[model samples]
Target: MDTEFELFDDDKSDVNAPPSYHAVSMSSISADSVQCEPSFVFSKAQTKQIRTTVLSLIRGMVITPDFILSSVGPTLDACATSLPAAEFTDILQESNIEGHTPLYWAIVNKRPEVLSAFHKFITAYKNDSFHDVRLACMVTNDHTLFTKLSLTSARLHKMERTLNLSLGCADEIQVYEGDTENQFTAKMQITMFQTRIRVVQKLRMEFIAQGRIWGLLFHVGDDTRWEASIYLSKHSLPARPKALLTVEAQNEQHQVLKKEFKLKEGCFLAASEYTNFSIRTCTSTSASLGSWPIFNDTIYMDSNGTLHAKLDVALQ
Candidate 1:
């Protein structure tokens, strides 16, 4: 933070006198002047005029190009005023000077008012351009704008819909085989955690309703012994908890295939012929697998039955 005042030598001060009685003077003062500078004042009518001018210019930039040249000062002052909620999406979506949007000017000038107006406009329109507005808001660290946009029901719905649709389209799951030296390595990437969990739950329920066991291979280690589990019903499954896996070492590799299981009650029984192996040496071959009941990724089964991998199509 910078200050407006400057320090100067006070030549009139009596250095030897008591501190309370000491006098000080600066070089630039007029000795007879006893008044301070007049404060700035604007009449209500003037203030209204200024706001109208500024808002008009802003609106013009959005709906037309005639006001671009005269928008600078008025737009700034309007930002400094308390005005009615205004929509500037048109400006963001339409106004461009050689590829530069009005948002560019707003950020460059550090105009929170302009940015806020734009944010409100974007949220209302629920346009694809909201992404750009979001990025700009983040870059500017505009808390008010960010919060407003983030809390919009439309925006939230858009995000959820996108995640669900992507999950539905997921196609490939490849379990990378590692070397024997790195048998414990099980890399996991759960791109959309909540969505993926929901999909898995739906799949488990569908399998149980049909009296079929959901054959899932939980990779244990280099030991080639695995087991399969069967889910009995959806209501029996445990509520999915928040889960995150960002590293290979964090994966819990318990190679087992259970049968006749209830999700809520946990695995009921394990398959008699279980086989587990080191993920690194399982097999280089990648298989074309089916989509999970609710998610899009194709499920790939490794030759060694030790690892399972899914390619994230949601991100694409």
Candidate 2:
């Protein structure tokens, strides 16, 4: 009974769902809408043109953040606009003959201001070079820079698919915040990750939202298939009437899969203190494990066997 595990101090849900607990059909689980056309292929000359323009953008010895944000990003955007979405995304992730990408150079050069400038540029298409650029960030040894870029990468992935490859939680933990015009969207990330293997594992990540204390407790051990259980120390304020909880992770194919829980009705019972609301059970929801989930038993692991999980609660 840790006082700081305050979010769900009163939660008493079990690892196994009770007969009274209704397991909603997994209908909402599906791929995010992405229209991929096979016909959008780039010509050899066009690919070379894009690369040449990009390499020239960063050719100068001293690169300024302002130049990168204004000139480089816009120029890159124009290139992407001219091509099909799939082809443009693929080229954005490519390197020049020198074996380096614009992203890799931008980060390695330490132009901190220019990182988030590409947020829009990266998210507009399906770019999968996040983790690769992160490996290049290590040379700077700037944890703050590392953290900012880590968040930028997560934001680019937009919640469902996220990976944080910073040195460790040893440095200050970074929080990614989002809220709607209506209620609130409280997000949590297992910045630390692992792969599916026949072994027991455990981890913890603590974060703050609007000056309140919160945490995610994780346990990885599988009875049948590889399984994991993630528990948030608490839920939204008892005042909020209902909530929708969403959790997700990437798969072998790099597609982000999402599963949600509606915390209302019999599922989310509320009372004066902090009744047995559905969101709490959803929070206490036993993780299915792997690139994981109760959503699907698949987890995204880096070259090293670490797992990454993303959870967010929208109060309604």
Kindly list the per-residue Cα lDDT of model 1 for residues 160-227, writing each as its tens digit.
44554665532222233334322211133334432433433211111111111112322212332221
Against the true structure, candidate 2 reaches a TM-score of 0.34
**lDDT tens digits, residues 66-87, model 2?**
3434444544454445546565
Task: Give candidate 1's error at residue 292 in angstroms.
Answer: 7.5
Q: Give the C-alpha miss distance for residue 246 in model 2, angstroms.
A: 30
* Cα-lDDT of candidate 2: 0.39
lDDT of 1: 0.31
Please give the CA lDDT of all the candidate structures.
Answer: 0.31, 0.39
**Given candidate 2, what's the lDDT at residue 140?**
44
TM-score, per-candidate, Cα-based = 0.26, 0.34
- How many steric clashes does model 2 contain? 17
